[model samples]
Every structure is written in structure tokens, then in C-alpha cells.
Target chain A: MNELEKRLLDGFQRGFPLTERPFAEIARQLNAEEDQVIGALEGLSESGIISRVGAAFAPGGIGASTLAALAAPPERLEEIAELVNGFEEVNHNYEREHRLNLWFVITAPDRDGVDRVIAEISRRSGLEVLDLPMLESYRLNLGFDLQWS
Target chain B: MNGIPAIDHMDRQIVLATQEGLPLTARPYHAVAKRVGLEPQEVIVRMRRLLDQGVIRRIGVIPNHYALGYLGNGMAVWDVADESVLEMGRMIGDLDYVSHCYLRPRFPPEWPYNLFAMVHGHDRGQVLERVDKINAVMDEDARAHDVLFSTRILKKTGLRLPT
Candidate 1:
């Protein structure tokens, strides 16, 4: 990574200016041209380094969300996973190595919606659903320092 | 300003406008304000207030760890004692490798893990090393634990509010 890209990744994790010209503000801070800053950010996003430049809503604030899991038979794991992922409410689904392996996050517009999705997944997969909703968030920040090694 | 406070219509509009992502342009907020039919300054003020009120956790770049070569992401679940879970959670959350640490409910007889800590690394070995370190820190308080490595991303997207 070039110096400009490094700086952009390192610096813009937080405190992105809320202004008419945010790229310009970033440019001023980085001592680079406005277009160059925009270009670098575009490249980063294109390269999939950054998912998006936006607001991360507090969990369970605007919508109801819960971490749910299911133990799918190894032979049918892929089928069940695809079934669970079929729901639009299921945003993140993963296959883990455990008895209760098929874990996913169900995000819906409301508490009732979350319940509905869970019930649907359980019915479709014919497996017990373990709805482990977060009681308290000790830390939720995911940003980390980009080590240039 | 510290808890999940109620949001007004305008606040809802702002969230709906920027939930997917902020526009990648020189004037991103201006684009958002235009979409939400609010002035640029007003949008900024509302966003600041939202941040303070804990509605919006942050306004910044959200990176994809997998794409960044931190391929081995483990969701380490621990079966810690109820009394020590909170304290241990705080300590685990303080670790640089641990990105997300939360107190979640546990289903007994089948699922005994209550605490969830997400650790990431470039490979499975690195992730396991971090998990070992976390286990060392927890000591005997963590009765049992398991690492759940995500094999596939069935679906991944930001939470969407009812518009």
C-alpha cells in the first residue's frame, strides 16, 4: 500500500467529517488534493478494503436483531444453511464447527419480526433454534490498526 | 444521550437515507440531506446528536476484515460463571484482537456458552493462538469454550429500518 492509502485506511476509521464536502475536509487533514482523497477512497472501496463509508447504527436501536444458531446434520448442513439464508431478515449466516453449528444473525424491523424469522428458520430446517440475543454489549467497535507488514 | 433513546421522524429519515452507506463523494452529507430533504447543517447537527444519543454508534468507514486478509474470524463462545462473566467480558473487550465482546444468553443442556467474543487473524492458527490467550486470561472461570469459524457468508448486509 502507498503512503496515501495507508494514511487513508488508518485515519478514516472514525471522525469522518459531516460537512458539505467531506472529501475536501479529509484532503485538508491529509494534506492532499480533494480529488486525490476521493480517488483513494474509491480505490479502497473497489478493492474491498472498506465495506462502506457510513453510520453504524447501534444494535437493536432502529431494528430488532439477535444472534441465533442451529445444529444441522453434517450431511445436510449446506442445504439447511441455504434455507436459513433464504430469509431476507437473516443478514449474517455462518457454518461453525460444533453441535450447534449453523449460526446467523436475524435482523428485522421489530421484535415480532425477529421472532417470526426465527420460527420460520426452525420450521424449515426442522432443528431447534438457539436464540442468543445480546444482553449487554461490552465492546462493539470492529475497527483496527492496519499493520503494513 | 447514553441509551437507546427515541428517534423523531427526521431522525428516522436520516437513518434510512444513510443506512446502506454514505455517498462516496466530496459532499456526502449534502447528498444525504438532499435525499432526506434537510439542510446540510441541520443534517450534521442531527447526526452529531444521534451519535451522542447512541443511536448512531459511529460515522466512519466500515472495513471488511475478510477482504483485508484477516480470513480467520472466530466467534469464541465461553461458558463463564454468571457472576464473573461481566468482569471477564470487560477484560476480553479490552484486548486488541478481540473486536466484539458481548454478554449473551445461553441455552443449557445443549448450548452452555453465554459470552461471545469475536477474534480475527490472518489464519486459523493465529485465531486459535488468540483464543488460547483468552482462555488463559479466563482461567477456571471459563468452564468450557468453543470457537466457531465462519465457513461461508450466506448473507451479509447492514440492518435496514422500516422506512
Candidate 2:
């Protein structure tokens, strides 16, 4: 990656300007052209180095969100994971090294919507679902420093 | 969310229209306004309000940890007692290596962890060392803990509000 790309990925994790011409604003700060800034961001997104460049809502703020887990049998893990992924409500699902290996995040318009998805998943997979909703947060949005050589 | 100010229907539309991402164009908000059938200036104004209200955390480039060479993703869950959990969580969250930390409910005997700290590293050893540092801070206060390394990402998507 070039200096422009590296600086963009490292520096612009948060506090991106909100304006009609946000790319232009970024260019002003980084000493680059507005077009260069746009091009760099487009390239980063296409290369999978950056996911999105938009709003990140607080969990349970707009609607509701919860972290849930279920211990799927080794042989059924893939099948269960696929099943969980089928739900639009399941935004993130991961297989981790634990008995309760299949973990996922569920978001809904309301708390009941979140619970419905969990109940449906448990019923479909025939496994106990652990609903571990966040109680308190101890961290704020501290940006990341990406020093990839 | 008790203290969070409520947004109206139009604001919700703006969020739905741009939640995936802002356009890569120079006039990104203008494009969002077009999608949501609002004026360009209105989109910018509402988004600003959302940011101030904490309804929207931030608008920015989200780095893909995997692509950036962060191969090991460890979910370090620690069982800290209720009394000290707040201070303990703050200590762990203060770690430079900890990307984010939260206090969640424990399911007891089966799942005896209330504090979750995400530590990303180039490899398992590096991730483990970071987790060890957090453990050191908790000292004897930590009753039990375990680091669950993510083996696979089944799915990942931007947060989609139920429309």
C-alpha cells in the first residue's frame, strides 16, 4: 500500500467528517486531492481492507442487539452455523474454540424481536442458547492504529 | 438507552439508507439524501444530530482486521465478582491491545464469565500474551477465565436495522 492508503486506513477509523463533500474534507486534512481521497477509499473497500464508511449505531439504541451462543456438536457445527447465518437478524456469527463454539449477534427492532430470533434458533438447532446481553460498557470508541508493514 | 434522545421517522429512514455505508463519491451525503428523498443539507444536519445523540457512534472507514494481518481473534472472558467488575473491566478496557470490552451476563456453572475483552493479534501466542497481561491486572480477583480463539467467521455484515 502507498502512503496515502496506509494513512487512510490507520487514521480514519473514526471521526470522519459529515458533510456534503466528506471526501473533500478528508483531503483537506490529509493534504491530498478530493479525487485521490475518494479513489483511495474505493480501492480499500474493494480490496477488503475496509468494511464500510458509515454510521455505527450503539447496541440497543436504534433497536436492540445481543450476543448469543450455542454449543453445537462437532459434526453438526457447520450445518448449525449455516442455519444461524440464514437469519437476517444474525449479523455476525463465529466458530470459536470452546464447547459453546457457535456464537452470534442478533439485532432486532425491539427486545422481543431479539428474543424471538434466539428462541427460533434454539428450537431449530435443538440446543440450549446462552443469551449474554451486555449490561455495562467499559470502553468508548477508541480508534485503531493499523501499522501493517 | 434511557438517556438517549428519540429520533423521528424521517431520521430512521436516513439511517436505513446509509447504514451499509456512505457513497464513495465526493458528495456522499447528497447521494444519501437522494436515496432517502430528503435534501442534501437535511441529511447532513440529521446525521450530525445522530452523532451528537450517540444514536450513531461515528462515521468512518472500518478496517477489516483479517485483511490488516490481525489473524488471531481471541475473546477473553473473565469472571470478576460483581463488586469489583466495574473497576476490573475499566482496567482491562484500558489495555492498548484490547479492542473493546464489555460486561455481559454470566450463565453460571456452564458459563462463568461476565467480562468480555476482545484482543486481536498476528498469532495465537501474541494474543495469549495480551490476554495474560489482562489476567495479571485482575490478579487473584479473577476467579476463572478462558480465551476462546475464533476459528472461523461464519458471517459478518453491517448492522441492519429492522425496517
Candidate 3:
């Protein structure tokens, strides 16, 4: 990463300006041109370095969500995973290494919607779903320093 | 769990407008405010208030770990004693490698892990090393632990409110 890229990653993780011409504000702070700053951000997003430039809502603050797991038979894991991923509510689905290998996050506008999705997944996959909603959050922030090696 | 405070219609509109992302423009907030039919100044003020109220965690770039070359990410779950779990969780969460740490409910018979800390590293070995360090920190309080490395991402999307 070059100096400009490093600065972009470090400075913009949080506290991005909330104003008209926000990119211009960033450019002023970094002593770079407005277009350069915008171009760099565009490049970063295009390269998938940053998912998006937006707000991250607190869990359960804006909508209902739950972490669910399923113990799919190894032979049928792929098929069952595809079935589980078919739900729009299932935003994050991952294949982990465990008996309860197929873990996913179901988010909805309300608690009832979350439960409905879980039930549908259970019925469709023919597997028992272990719904583990977050009881307490010690730390939920995902921003971190990008250590350039 | 605390009751969720009801958000007003305007707040809902603001969230809906920015749920995907702020527009990439010289005047992004103005663009969003325009779409939501609110003044740019009002949009900024509302966003600031939302941040203060913990409704909006942060307003910034959300980095993709996998794209940043942190390929090995493990959801390390631990069977820590309930009495010391919170303190242990705080300690684990303070580690730089641990991004998200939460106390989630554990199911009996099949699932016993209650504490979860997401560990990220450049490779599988690095992730395991971090897990070992976490285990060492927990010491005897951690009865058992397991690291479930994600093999594939079936679906990944940001949280979005129903429109």
C-alpha cells in the first residue's frame, strides 16, 4: 500500500465527514486533490478493499437478527447449504468445520420474521436449527488497522 | 434485552436511503437528503444524533477482510465458565486480532460453546496461533474451545431495513 492508500484506510474507517462534498473535506484533510481522493476511494471499492462507505447499524437496534447453525451431514452439506442460502433473510451463510457446520445469520425487520426464516430453513433443509441470538455484546466493532507488511 | 426505541418516519427514510451506501459524489449527504426529501443540514444533524444514540455504529468505510488478504478468519467459540466468561470475554476482545466478541446462548447436548470471538489472520496457521494465544489467556477458565474456519461464503450482505 502506498502512503495515500494507507492514509485512506486508516483515516476513513470511522469519523467520515457528514456534509455536502464530504470527499472534498477528506481531500482537504489529506492535502490531496478532491478528484484524487474520490478516484482512490473508487479504486479501493472496485478492488474490494472496502465493502461500502455507509453506516453500520447496531445489532437489534434497527432490526431483529439471530445467529443460527445447522448440523448437516457431510455428504449433503453443499446441497443443504445452497438451500439455506436461498433465503433473502439469510445474509451471511458460511460453511464451518464442525458437526454444526452450516452457520448463518438471519436478519429481518422483526423477531417474528427472524423466527419464520429459521423455521423455513429447518423445514427445507430437514435439519434442526440452533438459534443463538446475541445475549450480550462485549465488542461488535469490525474496524481495525490494516497492517501493511 | 432492552426494548428497541421506535424510530420516526424520517429516521426510517434516512436509513433506507443509506442502507446500501452513501452515493459516491462530491456532495453525498446532499444527494441522500435530496432522495429522502430532507435538508442536507437536517440529514447531517440526524446522522450525528443517531451515532450518539448508538443507532448508527459508525459512518465510514467498511473494509472487506477477505479482499484485504486476511483470508483465514475463524469464529473461535469457547466453553468458558459462566462466572468468569464476561471478564474473560473482555480480555479476549481487547486483543487486536479479535474483531467481534460476543456472549451468545449455548445449546446443550449438541452445542456448548457460548463465547464467540472472531479471529482474523493472513492464513490458517496464523489464525490457529491467535486461537492458541487466546486459549492461553483464558487458561483453566476455558474448559474447551473450537475454531471453525469458514470454508466458503454462501451469502454475504449488509443489514438492510425493509422498504
How well is each residue in B1-163 modelled by candidate 3, as lDDT tens digits? Answer: 3554656789889988998788788889989889999999999999998888788878888888999899999999999899999899889888888888989998997899899999999999999999998888789999989999999888888765654
lDDT of 1 by residue, A55-119 (tens): 88888777778999888989998899889877877877877777877888887767899999888
**Mind giving the per-residue lDDT tens digits that candidate 2 earns over B15-96?**
8888788888878888888998989999888889988988887778888888888988799998898999989988888777
Between 2 and 3, whose DockQ is larger?
Answer: 2
Judge the docking of candidate 1 as incorrect, acceptable, medium or high.
medium
Give the interface RMSD of candidate 3.
1.6
- What DockQ do the predictions score, one after another? 0.68, 0.79, 0.73
Q: Model 1: what is its DockQ? A: 0.68
Q: Tell me the tens digit of each residue's lDDT in model 1 across B102-152.
A: 988888888888999999889899999999998998899999999989887
Q: What is the per-residue lDDT of model 2 for residues A1-149, given as tens digits with 9 covering 90 to 100?
A: 88899888777888889776888888999999999999998998999988988878877667778999999999999899999999998889999999999999999887999999999999999999999988887877556666565
> What are the per-residue Cα lDDT tens digits for candidate 3 across A1-149?
56776798888888888877888889999999889888888888888888888998887877788899999999998899889877877878998888888999887888999999888888887789999998888775857867888
- Per-model TM-score versus the true fold: 0.94, 0.97, 0.95
After TM-score superposition, the amount by which residue B86's alpha carbon in candidate 1 deviates from its true location, in angstroms, is 1.4
Ranking of all predicted structures according to lDDT, beginning with the best and ending with the worst = 2, 3, 1
State each candidate's chain A TM-score: 0.93, 0.95, 0.94
All candidates in order of DockQ, best leading = 2, 3, 1
lDDT value, residue A60 of candidate 3: 84
Mark the regions of model 1 whose C-alpha exceeds 4 Å error after superposition. A140-142
